[model samples]
Target: MKTDSLVFWWRSLALLLAMGLLALVLQPFFGGTIALATMLVGVLGLLAYHLRNLHRLGRWLNDPGPETVPESYGAWEAAYGQLYRLVRSQGKSQRMLSAALDRFVAAGEAMPEGVVVLDSQDRIEWCNPKSMQHLGLDRKKDLGQHIAYLVRLPAFQQYLTAQDYSQPAILRNLAGGDSVLSVQLVPFDSTRKLLLTRDITQLERVQTVHRDFVANVSHELRTPLTVVGGFLETLLDLPDMDPASRESQLKLMFEQTGRMQRLVEDLLALSRLENGIEIREDRVDVRSLAQVLATEAGGLSKGRHTLRIELQEGAGGVRGNYDELHSAFGNLVSNAVRYTPDGGEIRLKWRVEDGCGAFSVEDSGLGIEAQHIPRLTERFYRVDRGRSRSTGGTGLGLAIVKHIAQRHQARLDISSEPGKGSCFCIRFPTNRLLEPEELVTSGQ
Candidate 1:
């Protein structure tokens, strides 16, 4: 009972005592039997009232529906009001807990990584949408199914049964596809665990690129350094060397140093492009730019390859950084010159197709195989390392071209056969191309 109920009960007891004392005092004026009757009547009335309130309280405890608490006087009223307040408080707490649970679920669903809840039996209980994407699982269909049976990967089955989730397991080429998932288990409760999966294909690719970059850079620098060091040792130890021999040695050393310098410059250029250089909104004339690049290619080729420039007025202009676009176009033209044979033909063209500007460099050289075409843009990747060195390439030309094209929202389409020829084209979207009037106003 409540404080108010206790106080009301005490007050009623005091009133009953005063009535009994009055009845006892009235025994002298009236008879003893009359006084006893009066006391008995008053005591019975008090008992009846208390019994009625007790019944109301018992009924409320039994049913406890949405109806208001029944009316009563004194202690019963206090009891009813307190019960209602307690019920409302508990309802508010329950609602708050439910809201918190909902927010937690929402947050889990919004996560990029896949989340799965599994029972102790390695059965799927719940999974987020990302899990569906990463694991190729249907939430409704896969639920209650054993995870090992559904996954069907031997390594994954082993991982699940191991029960030692200290580290994540790498699942490569899962779902008979090219996806890489890093999976780890969190034993959150005694009977269940949380399975987490992250699609790490892109991360793995980046790591591979980083490793290859390091190895390639070391190899490239080692070659030139070795050559230069050998030549310097020859000059230093052989003081009586002939002047002609010394001159030849020095010339070779200079060439090696130049090669190393070119390699470093290309590496730095590629790094800048990858790290995001500022793209200017200047108007770039495809025809004029191609002409300049072709001229530069002629110098680089030194008449080793026959070069031709074809300007077909592709949307007149493109909007981008002039120097960057020039560098990209220059790299493509120079690559063609270096890769093509002495008497081979290289055609440079700029034209519009489907309202998009396309710049192409076609070379009648040792064309790439179809399998090697996909990774041609990877930095330092070479189909023929020896041929690349002989052709005086830094092995980053196409990579640089790819980055610049991407920066300008362009796509590089490469078509090549083993012996026929290879055509490399950078196609700019229509928005990146400027019409005649726009080009004129843009001062191209």
Candidate 2:
């Protein structure tokens, strides 16, 4: 027994002894009648007190601490031992539950997707950090508040009631930014639900762009194809045509075929450039390269446009695939020559700017509008479709140039004043441009 229990038992025994002694003293003072009455009362009182103490001791001995169990005095030892074991088992179970809950909380917090839990009344019960960040929630203020009331969006409210789990609805961010979010609601327990949110702005943009590209490409190709077909049918029907008419028809057919071929070739080149086929990096001498391209472009222009070359001395060579760099510069020069009016001057310049080589082509031609400048590199995009077709442009030249610049980690900058002229400039990174000695030491 414990010291406290022993002390209690001793005090109880002394009280009983004192009561018995008092009964004996009363018996001596008032003979049998008085003593018997006093003895009876004392015995009854003592019995009641003893019964109460016994009950209390039984309760203490059989207590399962925080847990409750039935008292068993007849088998006190066994009951007491079982009570302790039960208490320990309960404690271990509670600890295990706590640990599991902690782990669950940690996992939920770590998730990139926003997670929120709602109660039976559709009130915000709990939410992870991501959920709070995504929804711009204040836990203390928002807790126990109805989700419908807080969100206030009609679409989301309808989604909750409809229970349509097929597709998620897009929700605008409440955090005051142009952020788009896709939200999904999942039914959990009897009256609980889990809400998931994901950022899909970029994905949505890509999907929109893809849809537009397909429609645009189809329309563009179909228009030319339809024209070619009609012209071919006309030529075939005129079996006895004059030589001049036949020659004209054949020339028209040839032009259409050439246009289609150019479009196909440009498409293939752009695809290859985007598909990550590694290209050999070599020192590209912009000065000599620009001169050669100018010569070729001059011939292609048929003396209709004047080509001028300005190469800065010691302009330092750029490190890139020579063919791709050549193609990029060639496209710019060709486009300039094609767009400029007859006898118009087309300037090709190469120079070192801010520790990097900058190659620019400026043409006195119909310039692009400011709004169209941002999307000028989009494949098959043209400001003036009629002019582009007339010039035999595949509409992929600038797109190809943009891709090549990206591959070589170069920056392309375009500046144009409508009707004044346009300049297409490509600036190579400093590391990509090396001194002549460095190039020579690296075996060119």
Q: State TM-scores per candidate.
A: 0.80, 0.76
Candidate 2 structure quality by residue, lDDT tens digits, 1-444 = 364455555665776687778777887678878877776787787678667646865776565463554443322434344556767788899999999999999999999999989998889998888888777777889988888887766778788888786789888755567778888988888778888988887898889778987887677688778878987898789888899988887788788878788788888898999899998988776766877898899798998987888888777678888889888999999899888888788999988988877999999988878999998998778989889888889888999999999999998999999988899999988889877654532332
The per-model lDDT (C-alpha) reads 0.86, 0.82
Cα miss at 404, model 2 (Å)? 0.6
lDDT of 1 by residue, 1-444 (tens): 468668776768786998789798989999999999999988898889889888877888787743656777664667677677777777789899999999999999999999999998879999999988988889878999988877878778889888789999999878789878999999978889999999999999999889999999999989989999999998899999999999999999998999999999998898899888576678887777777788898888888888898887434879888888888888888788888888999999988998889999999988998899999999888999999997778889999999999999999999998787899999999889876566543444
Best by lDDT: 1
Pairs that collide, model 1: none
Query: Which residue runs of candidate 1 sit more than 4 Å off their true CA positions?
Result: 11-49, 65-68, 113-200, 236-248, 302-304, 313-315, 435-444
Where is the poorest 10-residue window by lDDT in model 2?
Answer: 70-79
Q: lDDT, candidate 1, residue 82?
A: 69
